[model samples]
Target: MRHTPPRAVEVHKALLAHFGPVDWRPSLPPVDELVSTILSQSTTDGNRDRAFERLKARFGSWEVVRDGEVAAIEEAIRVAGLARQKAPRIKAALQFITDRRGALTLDFLRRMPVEEARAWLMQMKGVGIKTASIILLFSLGMPAFPVDTHVHRTARRLGLIPPNTNAEKAHYLLEAALPPETYLDAHLNLIRLGREICRARKPDCPRCPLRAMCVYAREQGSGGARE
Candidate 1:
């Protein structure tokens, strides 16, 4: 008999059974969340937090960061890794928004349609589908799904998306496959699952909640067919 790949919703349900409830709500405003997400690229959470705090402490405001010397801004975020690259991108993004909207706040995105807002954010220097979705879903309370490295890998292992699908395309596919209400929980749990069980290097497939339904786990002989 041929095995059918699990649906995204089915995988989501399995994840919930394993990981339980997760809080994915964003406590920060859109702009703050944008900056934080930018800082998160290519860095650990601890380093990202320290870099964010340092930048905020040094600049005092987004406008100052945007207008300040690039070298100074880079110095403030040196601990985040890729500070030279990230600092310019962050400053340019803030400047882009300020130039277009005349302010640093992204409250306007909350009013725009999801796709429109996503497109608008994508126009920024370093923003992409993942970053735009993060701003939309977390900060603006939209239904967009942001696919990071973990979510991308987990989705592929579960066969929720094509094996070769890039994270950028996977974002839309996964978002479309799942109900809007399930996005937050599914996204959060998938990240946790990826971190704890379905890791990139050596996933603990035997103990994975979705192992029975996971194509990768099945191929590895770590999990059997679903009962």
Candidate 2:
């Protein structure tokens, strides 16, 4: 853990204010979220959605997708930009879940504590902390905050976290401070804020709600805190 900063709280509040009552995530079966998150790794959401739609349309069921040919799965998700690499892992993850729990329902993971569920998800072949946290937060509605590139960059710029704070450490640091109930909405709000205002290359500081709290903005003198 690191020293707490007032800027962090201010930025968090400003993001929540702008993104008001975040509710973008849809409840899905845990396996679906896991698969979708994997598909989304290096691709846009539109392409990932297209790939997911193809998988659903082609397979007709999760069971079919789990047992389908790797090539077929790759073809279905080709639009996601890494189908060749992602295909086997996605299939393997589905198989892993079904083998362990018989069903890929959110109930299995959602029933456990965040730490335990995170461990369970990480056991899957392609799932890492970020992916696992996503499953816990989005699928199970658990108190796991996932830090993507946007959140990581914004936190660093706002001086909410120290330089080069890895996503795993950042996750723990953030979750420890915020109430568990705020985890879901905060994650969404932060992502929206990151995309809309606190962009990586060119932050819209003048129009930003948390402009007053941004160390990078205050330090335009330091050439804008390039990473």
Q: Give all TM-scores, in the order shown.
A: 0.93, 0.91
Model 2 / residue 87 / CA error / Å: 0.8
lDDT of each: 0.87, 0.80
Candidate RMSDs in order: 4.3, 2.6
Can you tell me which runs of candidate 2 are displaced by over 4 Å?
1-7, 221-227
**Model 1 per-residue lDDT tens digits across residues 1-227:** 52333587788888888778785556878888888898999999999999999999999999999999999999999999998889899999999999999999889887888889999999997899999998888888899999999999888988889999998899978877888888889899999998998888778878887877788988889742232
Task: Specify the highest-lDDT model's number.
Answer: 1
Q: Write the per-residue lDDT of candidate 2 for residues 54-92, one digit (tens) a residue.
A: 989989987898889999999999999889889999888
**Global CA lDDT of candidate 2, please?**
0.80
